[model samples]
Target: MSAFDCIDTFITGGTAVIELNRPRQLNALNRKMVSEVVEAMESFDRNEEVQVIVLTGKGHSFSAGADIDEMAEDDPIRLELLNQFADWDRLSLIKKPIIGAVKGFVFGGGFELALCCDLLIAASGTEFSFPEVSLGVMPGAGGTQRLTKLAGRTKALQWLWTGERIPAEDALTHGVINQIVSPELLMEETLKFAAKIAKQPPLSLRLIKDSVNKAVDYPLYEGMQYERKNFYLLFASQDQKEGMNAFVEKRKPEYKGR
Candidate 1:
Protein backbone atom coordinates (compact mmCIF):
# COMPACT_ATOMS: atom_id res chain seq x y z
CA MET A 1 0.00 0.00 0.00
CA SER A 2 1.20 3.50 -0.86
CA ALA A 3 1.82 6.05 1.91
CA PHE A 4 0.70 9.06 -0.11
CA ASP A 5 -2.52 10.62 1.07
CA CYS A 6 -2.68 14.28 0.04
CA ILE A 7 -1.18 13.56 -3.38
CA ASP A 8 -2.56 11.69 -6.37
CA THR A 9 0.20 10.18 -8.50
CA PHE A 10 0.20 8.37 -11.83
CA ILE A 11 2.41 7.79 -14.86
CA THR A 12 1.70 8.30 -18.56
CA GLY A 13 3.92 8.51 -21.61
CA GLY A 14 7.10 8.33 -19.54
CA THR A 15 5.92 11.25 -17.36
CA ALA A 16 4.81 11.04 -13.77
CA VAL A 17 2.07 13.36 -12.57
CA ILE A 18 1.88 14.25 -8.89
CA GLU A 19 -1.25 16.27 -8.27
CA LEU A 20 -1.97 17.84 -4.91
CA ASN A 21 -5.35 16.50 -3.90
CA ARG A 22 -6.60 18.84 -1.17
CA PRO A 23 -8.74 21.15 -3.24
CA ARG A 24 -10.89 22.33 -0.32
CA GLN A 25 -7.83 23.76 1.39
CA LEU A 26 -6.36 24.96 -1.90
CA ASN A 27 -3.87 22.10 -1.78
CA ALA A 28 -2.11 23.57 1.22
CA LEU A 29 1.19 21.97 2.17
CA ASN A 30 1.22 20.37 5.56
CA ARG A 31 3.76 17.97 7.02
CA LYS A 32 2.01 14.95 5.57
CA MET A 33 1.64 16.50 2.15
CA VAL A 34 5.26 17.63 2.06
CA SER A 35 6.49 14.18 3.06
CA GLU A 36 4.30 12.57 0.42
CA VAL A 37 5.60 14.92 -2.24
CA VAL A 38 9.20 14.13 -1.38
CA GLU A 39 8.51 10.40 -1.42
CA ALA A 40 6.77 10.63 -4.77
CA MET A 41 9.62 12.63 -6.26
CA GLU A 42 12.20 10.15 -4.99
CA SER A 43 10.20 7.25 -6.35
CA PHE A 44 9.92 8.82 -9.77
CA ASP A 45 13.60 9.72 -9.79
CA ARG A 46 14.45 6.03 -9.37
CA ASN A 47 11.96 4.85 -11.98
CA GLU A 48 13.77 4.30 -15.28
CA GLU A 49 10.55 4.58 -17.26
CA VAL A 50 9.73 8.05 -15.97
CA GLN A 51 11.72 10.69 -17.78
CA VAL A 52 9.78 13.72 -16.55
CA ILE A 53 7.54 14.64 -13.65
CA VAL A 54 4.64 17.08 -13.73
CA LEU A 55 3.43 18.62 -10.47
CA THR A 56 0.08 20.39 -10.22
CA GLY A 57 -2.91 20.71 -7.96
CA LYS A 58 -6.47 19.53 -8.35
CA GLY A 59 -9.48 21.89 -8.51
CA HIS A 60 -9.04 25.63 -8.84
CA SER A 61 -5.78 26.27 -7.02
CA PHE A 62 -2.28 25.01 -7.45
CA SER A 63 -1.78 25.70 -3.74
CA ALA A 64 -2.65 28.54 -1.43
CA GLY A 65 0.47 27.95 0.70
CA ALA A 66 1.33 26.10 3.89
CA ASP A 67 -1.54 24.98 6.03
CA ILE A 68 -2.10 27.76 8.51
CA ASP A 69 -3.73 25.40 10.95
CA GLU A 70 -0.64 23.24 11.01
CA MET A 71 1.63 26.23 11.37
CA ALA A 72 -0.43 27.71 14.19
CA GLU A 73 -0.14 24.57 16.21
CA ASP A 74 3.61 24.31 15.99
CA ASP A 75 5.65 25.58 18.90
CA PRO A 76 9.33 26.42 18.81
CA ILE A 77 10.34 22.87 19.71
CA ARG A 78 8.16 21.30 17.04
CA LEU A 79 9.25 23.83 14.48
CA GLU A 80 12.86 23.02 15.33
CA LEU A 81 12.12 19.35 14.90
CA LEU A 82 10.56 19.98 11.52
CA ASN A 83 13.63 21.94 10.46
CA GLN A 84 15.85 18.96 11.23
CA PHE A 85 14.09 16.92 8.54
CA ALA A 86 13.69 19.56 5.83
CA ASP A 87 11.80 17.88 3.04
CA TRP A 88 12.20 20.82 0.70
CA ASP A 89 15.94 20.32 0.79
CA ARG A 90 15.49 16.78 -0.45
CA LEU A 91 13.06 18.02 -3.09
CA SER A 92 15.65 20.41 -4.49
CA LEU A 93 18.07 17.53 -4.98
CA ILE A 94 15.81 15.46 -7.22
CA LYS A 95 17.76 14.18 -10.26
CA LYS A 96 14.92 14.01 -12.78
CA PRO A 97 13.26 17.04 -14.34
CA ILE A 98 10.14 18.41 -12.73
CA ILE A 99 7.66 20.76 -14.38
CA GLY A 100 5.16 22.73 -12.35
CA ALA A 101 1.71 23.39 -13.80
CA VAL A 102 0.40 26.19 -11.67
CA LYS A 103 -2.95 27.98 -11.42
CA GLY A 104 -5.09 29.96 -8.99
CA PHE A 105 -3.41 30.85 -5.73
CA VAL A 106 0.34 30.13 -5.50
CA PHE A 107 1.62 31.83 -2.38
CA GLY A 108 4.26 31.39 0.31
CA GLY A 109 5.31 27.74 0.48
CA GLY A 110 3.36 26.99 -2.68
CA PHE A 111 5.49 29.46 -4.60
CA GLU A 112 8.58 27.95 -3.05
CA LEU A 113 7.47 24.53 -4.25
CA ALA A 114 7.13 25.85 -7.77
CA LEU A 115 10.61 27.31 -7.58
CA CYS A 116 11.96 23.83 -6.84
CA CYS A 117 10.71 22.71 -10.25
CA ASP A 118 12.87 22.95 -13.39
CA LEU A 119 10.13 24.86 -15.24
CA LEU A 120 6.76 26.36 -14.49
CA ILE A 121 3.70 26.76 -16.73
CA ALA A 122 0.98 28.83 -15.18
CA ALA A 123 -2.63 29.59 -15.96
CA SER A 124 -3.31 33.08 -17.31
CA GLY A 125 -4.90 34.43 -14.13
CA THR A 126 -2.77 32.63 -11.55
CA GLU A 127 -1.92 34.74 -8.49
CA PHE A 128 1.45 34.48 -6.68
CA SER A 129 2.53 36.06 -3.40
CA PHE A 130 4.59 35.72 -0.23
CA PRO A 131 2.09 36.63 2.46
CA GLU A 132 4.30 35.34 5.28
CA VAL A 133 5.26 38.91 6.16
CA SER A 134 1.70 39.73 7.09
CA LEU A 135 1.58 36.80 9.48
CA GLY A 136 4.58 38.04 11.51
CA VAL A 137 6.84 35.54 9.78
CA MET A 138 8.86 35.17 6.62
CA PRO A 139 9.30 32.48 4.02
CA GLY A 140 11.41 29.69 5.54
CA ALA A 141 11.30 27.12 2.75
CA GLY A 142 13.90 28.51 0.29
CA GLY A 143 11.42 31.17 -0.80
CA THR A 144 13.75 34.13 -0.24
CA GLN A 145 16.81 32.37 -1.66
CA ARG A 146 15.24 30.91 -4.82
CA LEU A 147 13.06 33.96 -5.55
CA THR A 148 15.99 36.32 -5.24
CA LYS A 149 18.11 34.12 -7.53
CA LEU A 150 15.38 33.83 -10.15
CA ALA A 151 13.99 37.40 -10.04
CA GLY A 152 16.93 39.53 -8.90
CA ARG A 153 17.10 41.30 -5.54
CA THR A 154 14.89 44.28 -6.36
CA LYS A 155 11.81 42.40 -7.55
CA ALA A 156 12.18 39.65 -4.95
CA LEU A 157 12.54 42.14 -2.09
CA GLN A 158 9.57 44.21 -3.24
CA TRP A 159 7.34 41.16 -3.58
CA LEU A 160 8.46 39.57 -0.32
CA TRP A 161 8.22 42.72 1.77
CA THR A 162 4.83 43.74 0.47
CA GLY A 163 3.28 40.26 0.49
CA GLU A 164 1.05 41.38 -2.32
CA ARG A 165 -0.29 39.02 -4.93
CA ILE A 166 1.10 39.44 -8.45
CA PRO A 167 -0.56 38.33 -11.66
CA ALA A 168 0.89 35.51 -13.78
CA GLU A 169 2.06 37.99 -16.43
CA ASP A 170 4.06 39.89 -13.82
CA ALA A 171 5.46 36.65 -12.51
CA LEU A 172 6.54 35.67 -16.03
CA THR A 173 8.08 39.08 -16.66
CA HIS A 174 10.19 38.66 -13.56
CA GLY A 175 11.30 35.20 -14.74
CA VAL A 176 9.36 33.44 -12.01
CA ILE A 177 7.25 31.47 -14.48
CA ASN A 178 8.25 29.97 -17.83
CA GLN A 179 4.94 30.38 -19.66
CA ILE A 180 1.27 31.05 -19.20
CA VAL A 181 -1.75 29.56 -20.99
CA SER A 182 -5.47 29.99 -20.60
CA PRO A 183 -6.92 28.09 -17.65
CA GLU A 184 -9.01 26.05 -20.06
CA LEU A 185 -5.89 24.78 -21.79
CA LEU A 186 -3.53 24.67 -18.81
CA MET A 187 -3.44 20.89 -18.31
CA GLU A 188 -3.48 20.11 -22.00
CA GLU A 189 -0.61 22.50 -22.62
CA THR A 190 1.38 21.25 -19.65
CA LEU A 191 0.96 17.59 -20.57
CA LYS A 192 1.92 18.29 -24.16
CA PHE A 193 5.09 20.03 -23.04
CA ALA A 194 5.91 17.21 -20.63
CA ALA A 195 5.43 14.65 -23.38
CA LYS A 196 7.80 16.55 -25.63
CA ILE A 197 10.49 16.56 -22.98
CA ALA A 198 9.87 12.93 -22.14
CA LYS A 199 10.79 11.95 -25.69
CA GLN A 200 14.34 13.21 -25.22
CA PRO A 201 17.24 10.97 -24.17
CA PRO A 202 16.92 10.53 -20.40
CA LEU A 203 20.67 10.60 -19.69
CA SER A 204 21.09 13.83 -21.62
CA LEU A 205 18.06 15.33 -19.95
CA ARG A 206 19.43 14.50 -16.50
CA LEU A 207 22.83 15.93 -17.39
CA ILE A 208 21.21 19.11 -18.71
CA LYS A 209 19.31 19.56 -15.48
CA ASP A 210 22.46 18.93 -13.47
CA SER A 211 24.47 21.38 -15.56
CA VAL A 212 21.91 24.15 -15.19
CA ASN A 213 21.64 23.63 -11.46
CA LYS A 214 25.43 23.68 -11.16
CA ALA A 215 25.47 26.99 -13.02
CA VAL A 216 23.29 28.41 -10.27
CA ASP A 217 25.07 26.87 -7.26
CA TYR A 218 28.70 26.87 -8.32
CA PRO A 219 31.16 29.59 -9.21
CA LEU A 220 31.25 30.55 -12.89
CA TYR A 221 34.56 28.84 -13.60
CA GLU A 222 33.55 25.66 -11.78
CA GLY A 223 30.14 25.66 -13.47
CA MET A 224 31.73 25.97 -16.90
CA GLN A 225 34.02 23.05 -16.09
CA TYR A 226 31.03 21.01 -14.96
CA GLU A 227 29.12 21.82 -18.14
CA ARG A 228 32.12 20.97 -20.32
CA LYS A 229 32.57 17.65 -18.57
CA ASN A 230 28.91 16.78 -19.08
CA PHE A 231 29.09 17.73 -22.75
CA TYR A 232 32.02 15.35 -23.24
CA LEU A 233 30.36 12.65 -21.14
CA LEU A 234 27.29 12.57 -23.39
CA PHE A 235 29.46 11.44 -26.30
CA ALA A 236 29.95 8.16 -24.45
CA SER A 237 26.21 7.48 -24.19
CA GLN A 238 24.48 5.06 -26.57
CA ASP A 239 21.80 7.65 -27.22
CA GLN A 240 24.46 10.00 -28.57
CA LYS A 241 25.57 7.48 -31.19
CA GLU A 242 21.96 6.62 -32.02
CA GLY A 243 21.01 10.28 -32.32
CA MET A 244 23.89 11.10 -34.65
CA ASN A 245 23.35 7.94 -36.69
CA ALA A 246 19.62 8.65 -37.00
CA PHE A 247 20.36 12.08 -38.47
CA VAL A 248 22.74 10.55 -41.01
CA GLU A 249 20.21 7.88 -41.91
CA LYS A 250 17.28 10.30 -42.08
CA ARG A 251 15.36 8.43 -39.43
CA LYS A 252 14.02 9.11 -35.94
CA PRO A 253 16.24 8.23 -32.97
CA GLU A 254 14.80 5.62 -30.64
CA TYR A 255 16.54 6.32 -27.36
CA LYS A 256 16.96 3.45 -24.92
CA GLY A 257 17.98 5.92 -22.14
CA ARG A 258 21.15 3.88 -21.53
Candidate 2:
Protein backbone atom coordinates (compact mmCIF):
# COMPACT_ATOMS: atom_id res chain seq x y z
CA MET A 1 0.00 0.00 0.00
CA SER A 2 1.12 3.54 -0.70
CA ALA A 3 1.96 5.94 2.10
CA PHE A 4 -0.99 7.98 3.34
CA ASP A 5 -0.84 11.17 5.38
CA CYS A 6 -3.51 10.38 7.97
CA ILE A 7 -3.35 6.58 7.98
CA ASP A 8 -0.97 3.66 7.40
CA THR A 9 -2.20 0.64 5.46
CA PHE A 10 -0.52 -2.72 4.98
CA ILE A 11 -1.44 -6.30 4.15
CA THR A 12 -0.19 -9.37 5.99
CA GLY A 13 -1.46 -12.91 6.34
CA GLY A 14 -4.33 -12.08 4.01
CA THR A 15 -5.51 -9.44 6.49
CA ALA A 16 -5.26 -5.77 5.56
CA VAL A 17 -4.80 -3.37 8.44
CA ILE A 18 -5.62 0.33 8.15
CA GLU A 19 -4.04 1.99 11.15
CA LEU A 20 -5.15 5.55 11.81
CA ASN A 21 -2.13 7.77 12.48
CA ARG A 22 -2.08 11.18 14.26
CA PRO A 23 -1.67 9.81 17.73
CA ARG A 24 -1.29 13.34 19.09
CA GLN A 25 -4.87 14.06 18.04
CA LEU A 26 -6.12 10.66 19.10
CA ASN A 27 -6.59 9.85 15.42
CA ALA A 28 -9.60 12.10 14.92
CA LEU A 29 -11.58 11.42 11.78
CA ASN A 30 -10.94 14.47 9.66
CA ARG A 31 -12.16 14.54 6.09
CA LYS A 32 -8.77 13.47 4.81
CA MET A 33 -8.47 10.57 7.22
CA VAL A 34 -11.96 9.33 6.44
CA SER A 35 -11.31 9.59 2.70
CA GLU A 36 -8.01 7.71 2.95
CA VAL A 37 -9.65 4.95 4.97
CA VAL A 38 -12.40 4.45 2.39
CA GLU A 39 -9.93 4.44 -0.51
CA ALA A 40 -7.59 1.93 1.15
CA MET A 41 -10.48 -0.31 2.16
CA GLU A 42 -11.82 -0.29 -1.39
CA SER A 43 -8.42 -1.25 -2.76
CA PHE A 44 -8.14 -4.08 -0.26
CA ASP A 45 -11.63 -5.28 -1.11
CA ARG A 46 -10.64 -5.53 -4.76
CA ASN A 47 -7.39 -7.38 -3.98
CA GLU A 48 -7.73 -11.15 -3.96
CA GLU A 49 -4.78 -11.45 -1.59
CA VAL A 50 -6.69 -9.58 1.09
CA GLN A 51 -9.67 -11.46 2.60
CA VAL A 52 -10.29 -9.43 5.72
CA ILE A 53 -9.81 -5.79 6.73
CA VAL A 54 -9.06 -4.46 10.21
CA LEU A 55 -9.46 -0.79 11.11
CA THR A 56 -7.62 0.50 14.15
CA GLY A 57 -5.76 3.52 15.48
CA LYS A 58 -2.14 3.91 16.68
CA GLY A 59 -2.71 5.85 19.88
CA HIS A 60 -4.00 5.31 23.40
CA SER A 61 -7.40 6.12 21.98
CA PHE A 62 -8.93 4.68 18.85
CA SER A 63 -10.49 8.08 18.06
CA ALA A 64 -11.83 10.94 20.11
CA GLY A 65 -14.33 11.71 17.34
CA ALA A 66 -14.52 13.80 14.19
CA ASP A 67 -12.23 16.82 13.94
CA ILE A 68 -14.24 19.47 15.70
CA ASP A 69 -11.88 22.17 14.61
CA GLU A 70 -12.20 21.21 10.97
CA MET A 71 -15.97 21.20 11.23
CA ALA A 72 -16.06 24.59 12.90
CA GLU A 73 -13.70 26.04 10.31
CA ASP A 74 -15.60 24.99 7.24
CA ASP A 75 -18.44 27.08 5.87
CA PRO A 76 -21.74 25.24 5.91
CA ILE A 77 -22.46 26.03 2.28
CA ARG A 78 -19.04 24.91 1.17
CA LEU A 79 -19.27 21.75 3.23
CA GLU A 80 -22.68 21.01 1.84
CA LEU A 81 -21.41 21.36 -1.74
CA LEU A 82 -18.41 19.15 -0.98
CA ASN A 83 -20.54 16.35 0.46
CA GLN A 84 -17.66 14.83 2.45
CA PHE A 85 -19.81 12.03 3.75
CA ALA A 86 -20.44 10.64 0.28
CA ASP A 87 -17.46 8.39 0.96
CA TRP A 88 -19.37 6.83 3.82
CA ASP A 89 -21.91 5.47 1.38
CA ARG A 90 -19.07 3.85 -0.51
CA LEU A 91 -17.60 2.54 2.74
CA SER A 92 -20.86 0.75 3.53
CA LEU A 93 -20.92 -0.82 0.07
CA ILE A 94 -17.69 -2.75 0.65
CA LYS A 95 -18.48 -6.48 0.30
CA LYS A 96 -15.69 -7.95 2.43
CA PRO A 97 -15.88 -8.26 6.19
CA ILE A 98 -14.59 -5.39 8.37
CA ILE A 99 -13.22 -5.76 11.88
CA GLY A 100 -12.83 -2.77 14.18
CA ALA A 101 -10.06 -2.80 16.80
CA VAL A 102 -10.96 -0.14 19.30
CA LYS A 103 -9.42 1.21 22.50
CA GLY A 104 -9.87 4.17 24.83
CA PHE A 105 -12.29 6.81 23.62
CA VAL A 106 -14.72 6.02 20.83
CA PHE A 107 -17.04 8.99 20.79
CA GLY A 108 -19.43 10.76 18.40
CA GLY A 109 -18.51 9.91 14.85
CA GLY A 110 -15.84 7.53 16.05
CA PHE A 111 -18.42 5.37 17.78
CA GLU A 112 -20.49 5.43 14.63
CA LEU A 113 -17.50 4.34 12.59
CA ALA A 114 -16.80 1.39 14.89
CA LEU A 115 -20.42 0.31 14.66
CA CYS A 116 -20.06 0.18 10.89
CA CYS A 117 -17.67 -2.75 11.21
CA ASP A 118 -19.08 -6.25 10.82
CA LEU A 119 -17.26 -7.23 14.00
CA LEU A 120 -15.64 -5.29 16.84
CA ILE A 121 -12.79 -6.16 19.20
CA ALA A 122 -12.52 -3.49 21.83
CA ALA A 123 -9.90 -2.94 24.52
CA SER A 124 -10.87 -2.99 28.15
CA GLY A 125 -11.55 0.46 29.71
CA THR A 126 -12.68 1.86 26.38
CA GLU A 127 -15.38 4.52 26.64
CA PHE A 128 -18.04 4.95 23.94
CA SER A 129 -20.61 7.72 23.66
CA PHE A 130 -22.65 9.84 21.32
CA PRO A 131 -21.72 13.32 22.48
CA GLU A 132 -23.10 15.12 19.46
CA VAL A 133 -26.41 15.83 21.15
CA SER A 134 -24.57 17.89 23.74
CA LEU A 135 -23.06 19.93 20.95
CA GLY A 136 -26.51 20.91 19.58
CA VAL A 137 -26.23 18.38 16.76
CA MET A 138 -27.10 14.71 16.64
CA PRO A 139 -25.23 11.80 15.12
CA GLY A 140 -25.32 12.31 11.37
CA ALA A 141 -23.80 8.99 10.36
CA GLY A 142 -26.34 6.27 11.17
CA GLY A 143 -25.33 6.25 14.84
CA THR A 144 -28.88 6.52 16.12
CA GLN A 145 -30.16 3.86 13.76
CA ARG A 146 -27.34 1.35 14.19
CA LEU A 147 -26.99 1.81 17.94
CA THR A 148 -30.72 1.34 18.43
CA LYS A 149 -30.62 -1.81 16.37
CA LEU A 150 -27.69 -3.29 18.27
CA ALA A 151 -28.28 -2.13 21.85
CA GLY A 152 -32.07 -1.72 21.69
CA ARG A 153 -34.04 1.54 21.62
CA THR A 154 -34.11 2.05 25.38
CA LYS A 155 -30.37 1.68 25.93
CA ALA A 156 -29.44 3.61 22.81
CA LEU A 157 -31.64 6.54 23.84
CA GLN A 158 -30.33 6.47 27.39
CA TRP A 159 -26.77 6.92 26.19
CA LEU A 160 -27.57 9.28 23.33
CA TRP A 161 -29.61 11.55 25.53
CA THR A 162 -27.08 11.74 28.32
CA GLY A 163 -23.97 11.66 26.19
CA GLU A 164 -22.61 9.36 28.87
CA ARG A 165 -19.62 7.14 28.40
CA ILE A 166 -20.25 3.43 28.14
CA PRO A 167 -17.64 1.07 29.57
CA ALA A 168 -16.39 -1.84 27.48
CA GLU A 169 -18.16 -4.29 29.74
CA ASP A 170 -21.54 -2.67 29.20
CA ALA A 171 -20.83 -2.47 25.48
CA LEU A 172 -20.18 -6.20 25.42
CA THR A 173 -23.35 -6.90 27.36
CA HIS A 174 -25.33 -4.79 24.92
CA GLY A 175 -23.87 -6.65 21.94
CA VAL A 176 -22.06 -3.61 20.55
CA ILE A 177 -18.67 -5.25 20.92
CA ASN A 178 -17.60 -8.80 20.12
CA GLN A 179 -14.73 -9.11 22.61
CA ILE A 180 -12.70 -7.08 25.03
CA VAL A 181 -8.97 -7.43 25.51
CA SER A 182 -6.37 -5.50 27.46
CA PRO A 183 -4.98 -2.45 25.72
CA GLU A 184 -1.57 -4.09 25.60
CA LEU A 185 -3.03 -7.05 23.71
CA LEU A 186 -5.59 -5.24 21.56
CA MET A 187 -3.79 -5.32 18.23
CA GLU A 188 -2.33 -8.76 18.79
CA GLU A 189 -5.71 -10.36 19.43
CA THR A 190 -7.43 -8.39 16.67
CA LEU A 191 -4.94 -9.50 14.03
CA LYS A 192 -5.07 -13.09 15.25
CA PHE A 193 -8.87 -13.08 15.01
CA ALA A 194 -8.74 -11.47 11.58
CA ALA A 195 -6.28 -14.11 10.37
CA LYS A 196 -8.66 -16.88 11.33
CA ILE A 197 -11.43 -15.39 9.19
CA ALA A 198 -8.99 -14.58 6.40
CA LYS A 199 -8.18 -18.25 5.95
CA GLN A 200 -11.77 -19.13 5.02
CA PRO A 201 -12.99 -19.52 1.46
CA PRO A 202 -13.14 -15.95 0.14
CA LEU A 203 -16.29 -16.36 -1.95
CA SER A 204 -18.14 -18.02 0.87
CA LEU A 205 -16.98 -15.39 3.35
CA ARG A 206 -18.14 -12.50 1.19
CA LEU A 207 -21.46 -14.11 0.38
CA ILE A 208 -22.23 -15.00 3.96
CA LYS A 209 -21.28 -11.56 5.16
CA ASP A 210 -23.62 -10.05 2.61
CA SER A 211 -26.38 -12.47 3.48
CA VAL A 212 -26.13 -11.79 7.18
CA ASN A 213 -26.06 -8.03 6.73
CA LYS A 214 -29.19 -8.27 4.61
CA ALA A 215 -30.98 -9.48 7.71
CA VAL A 216 -30.65 -6.00 9.16
CA ASP A 217 -32.05 -4.25 6.12
CA TYR A 218 -34.56 -6.66 4.62
CA PRO A 219 -37.72 -8.31 5.86
CA LEU A 220 -37.44 -11.84 7.23
CA TYR A 221 -38.71 -13.63 4.16
CA GLU A 222 -36.68 -11.38 1.84
CA GLY A 223 -33.53 -11.93 3.86
CA MET A 224 -34.07 -15.69 3.81
CA GLN A 225 -34.54 -15.62 0.07
CA TYR A 226 -31.31 -13.69 -0.37
CA GLU A 227 -29.44 -16.08 1.93
CA ARG A 228 -30.84 -19.14 0.22
CA LYS A 229 -29.79 -17.85 -3.20
CA ASN A 230 -26.25 -17.19 -2.01
CA PHE A 231 -26.12 -20.62 -0.38
CA TYR A 232 -26.98 -22.19 -3.69
CA LEU A 233 -24.66 -19.90 -5.66
CA LEU A 234 -21.64 -21.30 -3.75
CA PHE A 235 -22.13 -24.64 -5.49
CA ALA A 236 -20.95 -23.03 -8.75
CA SER A 237 -17.59 -21.95 -7.34
CA GLN A 238 -14.46 -24.07 -7.78
CA ASP A 239 -13.62 -23.61 -4.07
CA GLN A 240 -16.86 -25.41 -3.18
CA LYS A 241 -15.95 -28.41 -5.34
CA GLU A 242 -12.41 -28.50 -3.92
CA GLY A 243 -13.62 -28.10 -0.33
CA MET A 244 -16.08 -31.00 -0.53
CA ASN A 245 -13.74 -33.23 -2.52
CA ALA A 246 -10.92 -32.60 -0.06
CA PHE A 247 -13.21 -33.56 2.83
CA VAL A 248 -14.16 -36.79 1.06
CA GLU A 249 -10.48 -37.55 0.29
CA LYS A 250 -9.36 -36.76 3.87
CA ARG A 251 -7.13 -33.91 2.75
CA LYS A 252 -6.83 -30.21 3.57
CA PRO A 253 -8.65 -27.87 1.21
CA GLU A 254 -6.81 -25.08 -0.59
CA TYR A 255 -9.04 -22.15 -1.60
CA LYS A 256 -7.96 -19.92 -4.46
CA GLY A 257 -10.69 -17.24 -3.93
CA ARG A 258 -12.41 -18.54 -7.07
* Clash numbers, per candidate: 0, 0
Instruction: Give candidate 2 regions above 4 Å deviation.
Output: 73-77
Candidate 2 lDDT, tens digit per residue, 122-160? 999999999998888888878999999999999999999
- Report the C-alpha lDDT of model 1 over 1-258, residue by residue, as the tens digit: 345789999998899999999999999988789889999999999998899999999999999999888778678888797683478899988989899999999998999898889999999999999999999999988999999999999999999999999999999999999999999999899999999999999999999999999998899999999999999999999999999999999999999998
TM-score of each: 0.96, 0.96
What lDDT is obtained when candidate 1 is compared to the true structure? Answer: 0.93
Error at 77, model 2, angstroms: 4.2
